[model samples]
Target: MTIPTARTTAPFDAVLCDLDDVIRLFDATEVTRLERAAGLPVGSTAASAFGPGRGGPLVLGQLSKDAWAESTARGLADRVPAARARELAAAFARAPFRTDPEVVELLRAARARCPVWIVTNGTPWLDEDLATLDLDGLADGIVNSARLGVAKPDPGILLHAAGRAGAAPERCLFVDDRAANVEAAAALGMATVHFRTAADLRPALAPLLARPVPHPRR
Candidate 1:
């Protein structure tokens, strides 16, 4: 599908973007590797760590990082020693978080034009994760689900992100790798871009950057 462009008439005052699969890449292979190394079957780590019963509370701020790690370790204790499970959990928590230079450049350009906010459904260590990628200063603001006690596909976090950008929901442009999140923002009257790659993102954001910023009323 073609990338959707922002409306030129109203124009967006800010950009709200997702973290994983957009700014930072999450390696599924690494998770599988960790699972195997821990003597569990493939996908076991992901299922136990991110699956409904375990990771839901972590993402929603109900569980602390240590608690989530301990929970994940417990889930693996049958296959691996409890100590090894904890080690695996630590490795998973410290998984490679790399930033795309192209996306970073694009975000920097976008930030220069208007406010840019990182709106992500992440764990309790969201800030630490961003710091690892040197992405802490890239955006004007960050709204993490783990910290907010809400997540996307729920309009509250989107509205909260826009508020953090100091822009009204309708005046913000939201970009996410997930279709559900894009649709959720669009439902709230915000312009949405379903981001697939950096190439697609540039064109989607070009019009917003090219448009003249509206002056404040005297």
Candidate 2:
């Protein structure tokens, strides 16, 4: 979908972007393989780690990553050996989460034009994972939900990200793969791009970057 150019005269002051499925791509197949190797059913690992009352608290920063890992292991131990379960958890955590080189270049370009911040929902280990993907240095800042106690689709996190970028909510552009998140940001008066692919992203960001920066009042 085409993102319309900003109707206002002032260019966006910051760009807030999502991480998973946007900058870095997760491999579900690898996760499934790990689950099978651990003797758990397909999709079991996801259900145990990401379903309600499981990894949710971890993602919200209420539970420690170690605790979350232990919990996931326990859930898998019902079908596999405890040692195997723990191994599976560790392997999943260390899985190769890769970043799209094109997206990285785009992020760098966007940062040159305006402040860029990573606004993502993730556990405490997210920083470590981003570092592995060589994406930790691409943004001016990061607003992780685990540390902030809120996730996207909640306007609060989006506003918080704008604040971290030192920009008003209306002067920030939020890009995410989730429509719910894009809608939520739009509802809070932030310009949004529902990113799908590199093709969609380039056009969406073109007009924003082309607009002249707003001059400070004398």
Candidate 3:
């Protein structure tokens, strides 16, 4: 990766943001329907799908999405039939997600001042999802744990993200919905936004958003 030279003026030279629950939100309707049809509880699919034993390998790039789905199915084998469990797992795994427009706009505004990188613990299809959201190029770069064989709360991934953003950890603003991820970034000397609503980002990014983008000298 070609890391850019950090610009000195902005409060944050880079914005390292999370993807799931922060930018992309999943629709649980299909998963709910599948679980209900299989006589399972609403959160059962999610519980199995996201559990470390089943989902960890997928995020760490050790397992393919299909393999993860199969693992999740096996996790629910005692509760449902093999075929039904597989159906539920597949539906949950492939659940649709949408971008938070308000957050996207704010990030775009911040990008006018400095690079914005999506740093996330995500599956290999992460880029394809970004493309579906029309956000492929919204961020200057992306640091996907599935691609890197590491996940958040791990200092190495955060450091890799900061490097990709071309900023020292202290000069980057890390925004994530998870407190653990935020704390990890803070410990690395990066400013953090433990995001909840789009409003949570306004103040943290206000300094950069308020400034006008400078035109290149001809």
Q: 87-112 in candidate 1: lDDT tens per residue?
A: 77777766676887888888887776
Candidate 2, residue 103: the lDDT equals: 79
Model 1 TM-score is 0.80
Model 1 segments beyond 4 Å from truth? Answer: 1-10, 27-30, 37-41, 77-84, 211-218
Ranking by TM-score: 3, 1, 2
Candidate 2 TM-score to native: 0.80
Tens digit of per-residue lDDT, candidate 3, span 59-92: 8878777888998998899999999999998888
For each candidate, what TM-score against the reference? Answer: 0.80, 0.80, 0.90
Evaluate all candidate structures by whole-model CA lDDT and list the values in order: 0.81, 0.80, 0.88
Name the regions of candidate 3 deviating beyond 4 angstroms.
1-9, 216-218
| Model 2 regions more than 4 Å off | 1-11, 36-42, 77-84, 211-218
What is the C-alpha RMSD, rounded to one decimal, of candidate 2?
6.0
Compared with the true structure, the alpha-carbon lDDT of candidate 1 equals 0.81
